[model samples]
Target: MASPAPTSAPTTAERIRSACARSGGAMLAVEGLDPTTTPVHHLLDDGSFAITVPCDGSLVATVVSAGNAGVQAVLEMTDYAPLPLREPVRSLVWIQGRLRDVPIGEVPALLDLIASTEPNPALLQVNSGSSQGEGDTRLALMRLEIESVVVADATGAESVALSALLGARPDPFCGMESCWLQHMESAHRDVVDRLAARLPASLRRGRVRPLGLDRYGVQLRVEGADGDHDVRLPFAHPVDDVTGLSQAIRVLMGCPFLNGLRARGA
Candidate 1:
C-alpha cells in the first residue's frame, strides 16, 4: 500500500495500545542511552503501560542517572502494525512520555490489575521465583505518562491530544479486522471487484484490492504506476455490532443490484 498521510483521531492512543496489545512489543528508545532500541514487554491499561526492563541494562542506568535511580525517565514507544498490501506497513504510533518504575511491593498488584484486563504471559514471569526487593533489583517496572501520541495510517499522520486518545476506545471489529480482510481478499474477490466499481472511472483503471475494514468504512487500495492510492468508502453509519456492520457493507454493495439481482431466480 502507499505511504499513509498524516490524519488525526481522538482514539489514536487506544488504537496504538490495541496494536501493541495485539502485536506484542514495541521499539523503545531512551535518550542518550547506549542501546538505541530496547525490546521490552509492555502491558497497556488505562492510559499507560508498565514496561518490564532488565534491571542492569543501559536503559535502567539512564533512568537512575537523574539521582532518582528509583524513579522514571523520559522515553519513546513506537508501535507498528502490518497491513495486507505489498508495502505491508499499515500503521505507526509514536508515544513519548515519562517512564517511572513501580515499587517492588506493588508489582504483583499491578500485574493482577493488568491481568484483569488483558493477560500477557510475560507479566507472569515477573511474579514467579522472585522475592520483594529482589525482583526490583533484578528488573525495572517503568510506567509511561503519555505527553503526546502521533498516529500514522492510510489517512495520514496526525497528532492526537492525550485526553482525546485516552477517552476513546478501539473499534469494535479491531480484533477481527485482520482475518476478515484476508478472507475478503482471498475468498471474496468478486465483492472487491464490485466495490471497486463504485470508485470513479478514473480510479477503476488501476488494480483494486480490499485494503481494510473498520467501524467507519471499507478501504480500497488502487495500485498505479505512481504508487498505491487508498480510498475509503464511508459507511452510512458507524456499526459496533457485526450484524449492523454486515448490513452497512451490503448497503455499500447496493443491495438491490448486487444481492437482489442474483436472487431473482428464487
Candidate 2:
C-alpha cells in the first residue's frame, strides 16, 4: 500500500502546550542538582510555569541561595499511551527555563491566582501541609521563567518559541483523548485495522496501534522488529466536539453515511 499524503497537523507550539496541559506533573532537572519529581505544577498563561516543592527541600534551598539570579532548570513531561502498547511513552516535552522561588509572603497570592485558572488540591496542600512526619512535606511555590520549549512525540522533536507557545492553545478535547483512544483500542479493533490500510505496507506489517487523537487527526504507533514508528492519519477537517470527532472517524473509515448519522444524533 502507498503512504497516505500528509494533511494539516498541530504545530510544535500547540503540541507543547497540549502536552504540558495534559501532563499532571513533570520531572524537574535543575543544573547542579539531581532530578526530582514534581507532583503539582501548572503552566501559567505568560509561558512561565508555577511548581510546588517542599519548603525544606534541597531544590527550594538551591533556588533561594541563587537569589534573584535564578537557576537553570528543565521540566521533562512525558505523555503516555492510554492503552497497553509495546512502547508506552507517547511523547516527551522539555520545558527549559530559569527557576526562582516565590517569596513566602507572596506564595498565597500566587496559589490563588493559579487556582482561578487551573485548580488542584496540591495547591491547597501547599498551604495546610500534607503529612506530619519526621520531614516536613509542606510545599512551597516556585516559578520557572520559560526560555524555550521542545516537544518530542510521534510527530518528532521541534523547538518552539516562547511567544508562539504562549499564544497557542491546547486541543480542547485533550482531556478526553485518552478515553477515546482506549475505546478504539479495546472495542474498535476492526476500525483500527481499516485505518491501518491507509498506512504504507512497511508500517502495516507492524502492529498498528492507536497512539493519539487531536482536533487535527489520529496517530498510530507501529511496533516492529527494528523499533517503533509513529504515523498520523489526518482527518478530512478539524473537529471540535464529539459529534465532529465521530463524523471525522467515520469518514476515515470510508463511511460518508456514518458521518451524517453521527451529526444527526440529537
Candidate 3:
C-alpha cells in the first residue's frame, strides 16, 4: 500500500489541544444569551481560556451583574483549512465552562501570560487599553473556567477529560501549518503530485489538495466527483522539529534524493 495506514497518530487529547492553540475562530454561547463570535481567545497553560470582548457588550454586562456566580457557557473553536475547499472546516473543539469577568486590575497580568504563548496583537491592544491613565477600557477581559471538552473532526467526536487535556501539548508544527501548507500548494505542486500518486486510484478521480499538516503526518482532501474525502498519511514516526518533519515528508513523497540528503544531515 502506497499510503499505508498510520501506525499511530496524535491522540484525541493532543489533537484537541493543538486545535485549541492554533484555531483563531471561536463562538461563545452563554446560557440565556445569544452566541457571540469573537477572535480574541487564548487557551491558557492551565487548561482554562481567556477572551476579550467589547466593554459595552452584553456578555460583559451579564457577567458583571451575575457577580461571583458567573454564567454557564460553551465555546466552539473552529479550525479551518488553510486552503479553500468544498468543506473548509477541518475540526472543531467545544469548551464547556463557566464565564466570569476578570477584574480590570488583573486583566493585564493575564494578558501578559497568554501573550507568552500566542502573542496575538489583540492581547496587546487589551493590555495597553487596561493600563491607560484615565479612561474606560474598550476591551473587557473574561476568563472561562473549563469544566469539560469535546473535539470533533473527520474521524469523529470524542470527549476529553480536563486532566488529559492539561497534560497534552499542542503539535510543534501547528503554529506554522497554515503557512507551510500554503507554500506547499503554491510552490510545491510537483511534491503534491507525487503525494497524490500514493492515493488509491478511486480517490484520484477528482481534485486533490493539501488539507492539513501536523507533527504526526499530513492530511489530504480528495474532492471526489460525488463528494469530499479526507485521508491521513502518517509519518513513519512522529516528528518534533523541522528537520524530522522534512525527513518524514520526504519519505512519504518517496523522494529518494531528499531522503539521501536527510540521511546525510545535509
Top candidate (lDDT) = 3
TM-score-based ranking: 3, 2, 1
Better of 1 and 2 by lDDT: 2
In order of appearance, the predictions have TM-scores of 0.77, 0.87, 0.88
Best by TM-score: 3
- Worst lDDT run of 10 residues, candidate 3, spans 127-136
For every candidate in turn, the CA RMSD to the true structure comes to 6.6, 4.5, 4.3
**lDDT of each candidate versus the true structure:** 0.66, 0.83, 0.83
lDDT of 2: 0.83
1 or 3, greater by TM-score: 3
Q: Over the stretch 124-196, how does candidate 2's per-residue lDDT look in tens digits?
A: 6685754544554677788999888888865568888888878888998888888888988889899899989
Weakest 10 consecutive residues of candidate 1 by summed lDDT: 73-82
Which of candidates 1 and 2 is the stronger one according to TM-score? Answer: 2
Off by over 4 Å in 2: 1-7, 130-136, 154-156, 259-266
lDDT of 3 at 74: 92
Which ten residues in a row are the worst by lDDT in model 2?
A: 256-265
Models ranked on lDDT: 3, 2, 1
lDDT of 3 by residue, 1-266 (tens): 58876555788888887787787768889877778866578777676788877665688889999888999999998988999899999888898999898987887788778778777766655635546556544667788999989988887888999888878888889899999999999999988888889999999988999998888889899998899998888888888899999988988998777634544655
After superposition, the stretches of candidate 1 with alpha carbons farther than 4 Å from their true spots are 1-21, 34-46, 54-56, 64-84, 127-140, 257-266
Per-residue alpha-carbon lDDT of candidate 1 for residues 146-225, written as tens digits (9 for 90 to 100) = 66678787778988776776566666776787788788888888888889989998889888877667777888889877
